[model samples]
Target: MAETLATYEVPEHHVKMYTANVQAALNKEGGILTPLVSSNAYTGEKSQVVNFIGEVEFVERSTPYGDTKVTELEHTQVWISGREYDCAVFIDRLDTLKMIYDPTNPYVERFREAAARKMDEIIMSKFFADRKVGKDGTSTSAFGSANTVVHGNTGLTVAKLRSLRKLIKKRHVKVRTVRPKIAVTAEDVDNLLGEVAVTSADYAAIKPLVDGEVSSFMGFDFIPYEDNGGTSGDGKSIPSFQDSGSVVRQLPVWVPDGMHFGQWDGLTIKISDRADKNHIKQIHGTFTAGATRLEEGKVFQVQSKNAA
Candidate 1:
């Protein structure tokens, strides 16, 4: 006996609730490169150009008063574009109405978690591809193979931070006025600052180090982000930046709104019941977002191990 199927339209408020839940979960993860990049809300899926102030030279004064040479303010442009991400989850017809009433439904939480993870992967994979560190640690040009390491066996240290500061300065990136941030993975944190020699004087001097809390170091805020284990646009697993790894990729030191760009239409949600033969209802979340390293010099990547 075939059962009669009917279309069920999810209420507006219910859709809003799901959107809010997913957005909240996404925000909680915090951003490594996103916060430090230029972003804009765009409507269409066309190519957009993002501008940045470029290096300019001072004009020399002439003895004879001639027309002041008109020098155009220097600027550079990077085309910002993004791809769409859509995730759909099926909910049993029996509990569809129950979901609208109960915000604490397990299915809702599961969907939120899944969406947030995918969002992280999309952004981080772009970061890994666009803002790569080359074999020569001193090269301040573009992304290349992960061949440079920050600290040898010592991992991240105060000295390494100072070196990073120097490299940023050399790149002509101004860090004296606005301090840049250093983003490290959970693995890097453990290898770098998690351990302390109880008998050492350095351990006794700093209470946070002794207590295992490292919030800020060397004038830069430390952000701990777990590396993504998911696949990237190329269908390859996202690489790790841990010590003794084959591909030595790790955290990057970035100036806020300096090197990266994000083109976004934001995230929109839609509900449909006619699809899937009405036997299974669906909730879909769609987002059009993309990220790029607008300035190679502004983002610096360091390896977990020493370049041998």
Candidate 2:
């Protein structure tokens, strides 16, 4: 009798384990922006709409009941179109049996990280991108320049932070009520730590230099983002432009409610045998998601140097 080898077929228990692992990775490592913004879940459609209502004026009733004042409710909408994203890897049965350790875990981690990066990239692009608005979502509105803080041939600094805070204050946004957030690269943090004001005890309570990170300061929560995966069209992750022969980085600064993320299908995984490819085991992960800037007034751009 000839010896038989155990088949490397995917079992039901293994499928659940892989799915749980990928989901855990996404929640821990990949979801930096998902929880920081407005989120909505939809089904049976590829598009979702977020509605906003304008403030109504409250006029004093001098005559007590003079012809009952009437005001129409103003409504506007932002439409989010979900796009599918997926990643997959196949393992040959012979190779799986030959390997000392399983390779599925690494593939799951890769898929989780790629999906997470894509989500943040979408949110970052929406900060300055034109937004679809109006009743039918057929109108496009550009991000207002008044909300932008110019680079001035410098990196992230206290002065720029003050200017960014001032811009939001001028819009009458209550800083105490709605905490603002700013996403910065590692270079930006280094620039801040290099500043005398940030390191000096007279200006800051915590020593940023010793801490090696800026958790929060200047009435803005700092989000450390190193991934520079470029946006659509130009392929520059953090929007940048040439200024005086210097490449300036456009960092996004916005409130939580200013951006929206829509999900038609959450992160999902599938493990199956590919019959067309010699019965190789395939591990695949996918999701359908979209993000959009809810309003220009609540979102701003801070232009800084690409390098300190």
Best by TM-score: 2
Give the TM-scores of the predictions, in the order they appear: 0.72, 0.83
Once fitted onto the true fold, the runs of candidate 2 whose alpha carbons sit more than 4 angstroms away are: 1-7, 28-30, 70-73, 92-108, 197-199, 202-214, 229-236, 306-308
RMSD score of candidate 1 (Å):
6.2
lDDT of 2 by residue, 1-308 (tens): 43212346556766776677777777777666777998888777776677566557886777965888777765667877788878877765444423312335466667777888778767776777787787667888888889999888789888999989988999877798888988777677767767855456624632442444546777788877664545432322667777767768788888888888887757787877677876666777788987888876788889888553
Per-candidate clashes, comma-separated: 1, 2
Please, what are the lDDT tens digits per residue for candidate 1 over residues 150-239?
545555665676777777777787766777766565555555544444436544433353243446556676655553444333312334
Off by over 4 Å in 1: 1-7, 16-33, 55-64, 70-75, 93-116, 128-141, 144-154, 194-214, 231-247, 261-263, 274-278, 306-308
lDDT by candidate, in order shown: 0.57, 0.73
User: Model 1: how far is 204 from its true place, Å?
Assistant: 8.7
